[model samples]
Target: MITGYVIARKPMYDFSDVIIGRNSLLRIEDKYYHGIDRLNWIDVESRFKQSAIPENLLNVYTDLEASEQDLTGIKVLKKYDEAVVLMSLDEEMTLKNEILVIASNKLNQIKGHGIATVQTITWLGYDIVLLGGWSLIRHAIFENRQMSLLKVIALNSFGLLDNEEQADDFLKQYNKLADLDSVDPLLDNSSYGVDCIRVGVL
Candidate 1:
């Protein structure tokens, strides 16, 4: 079992509820930040740049409505809702020596649980782009049900760190290595250029 903090950012769609449906991903959960979860530093013009996020607080702030104030980040949005998930992974379910993260826009679908044929639709390098305030890097697919939630934020967001110093410090302390070219036979398909996780029978 591999344990870590996963922060997910969904850029395109706004969902009312985020459901976890996979067994490979266990202990699906999230954290609540009272005063720290404010969208004070989010700006529309600041595209391609990382936003200011307080420590230990997942930055779920999305700049959907630029003029709206106190709009409850990820709580309620006129257009869409963004969220972050934290959970664990069962390595035995993954392709040996390969770590896969899935970011899907689906609000009620997940990868099918149990051993089956999992294919890699594409390769999203560690330096992933951040369209929304954050990114979810866990694996989502076309399936019916299961458990777990590992947040995978945008690579550019660097876990939504405030500055270069913090980002660099984060890189230095990080030690997990995922093979971008590995062939995983029992994983979910990863979609590119869009946040889409389809649920299909395996």
Candidate 2:
């Protein structure tokens, strides 16, 4: 099974057809690739089934002490935290520009302190929504010593078309997705990412 920590997941349609020639996105270790490029959906599903979800990370961090260096550094920035998980649990559908930005914006809208960021991690396996934002937010509350069950770190998943005819029709109707006036999802998600891993250290 592939192993890695999740950071953030985004919705909306990109050039999956043109770029990777498949619908599912997968990240193995630190590299992102189309799931079909390496393995079929069945294998992907089985792997995820065997792989640990973000919620399971709590067991690893519980009772562990974090040092200052663990909170900041190049290694910390690019490194994956087994506890800091991100997931996309929807079919790859074309999104209206505004629609995709909503989930990524949640962190910036609320994280009043610290460096927050966002990254895309695709959940190509099953229908499980495991701990969506709770995994990260729980860490946040644990850091502040005001622990509760409110999961604030947001994640998003969008629907995608499996049929070539549907995708072609979508492209025709949309006509220039890039030029279509829409908020950039990445621009707003930077800080969200920072806050996500921040809790892992705490």
Candidate 3:
């Protein structure tokens, strides 16, 4: 199990009760700070630098109304609307994960060749990704759902921390060498209750 502080987070979606479904991505666009009608669904591919087209057509929508299509077959992975946190598992579990952090924009991004995506979707609107094998808590996010909250901020916005010293500091403290097979993340349950847990918007 992982034991860490959820130091920061951006807000979750304002998925309101609807009067219409004609367009639903407007709130999403707003969440990522997009201008009205300035967004293009086709632009998503380039923004995420994705070579393969997404399986779900609704993934790149630019509307203000939502439908069942928005879920893309992914069941919501966490309950109590548990806002995904920036989890840095304990050193005991770190040998497996090695504190690797990556940046991602795809909700369905795969954990390939010993890689795992970070639980947090956005940090001040930039995608937070991880690179390592999955622990039980981290794995649950993937096993229960096939989709991730798509990284919605603009491509240029990704530069927010790319050139800063803080980014380097974040990378240095988080990364570790590979040795993932030994740890059993299933045995840990520190995230559900408050030992070192704190959940809310940043």
Choose the strongest candidate by lDDT. 2
* lDDT at 46, model 2: 37
- TM-scores of all models? 0.17, 0.18, 0.17
Any runs in candidate 2 off by more than 4 Å, and if so which?
A: 1-46, 51-80, 83-105, 110-202
**lDDT (tens digit, per residue) of candidate 1 on 83-107:** 1211112222121112223232322
The candidate with the higher lDDT, 1 or 2, is 2
In model 1, the runs with Cα more than 4 Å from the true position are 1-159, 172-175, 179-202
- RMSD over all Cα atoms, model 1: 20.4
List RMSD in Å for every model shown.
20.4, 18.7, 20.0
How many residue pairs clash in model 1?
23
Off by over 4 Å in 3: 1-10, 13-163, 177-202
- Cα lDDT for residue 100, candidate 3: 17
**Candidate with more favorable, higher TM-score: 2 or 3:** 2
Q: Across residues 135-200, which tens digit of lDDT does each residue of candidate 2 receive?
A: 211111111222121221111221111222232332222223213422111222232232222111
Q: Candidate 3: worst 10 consecutive residues by lDDT?
A: 193-202
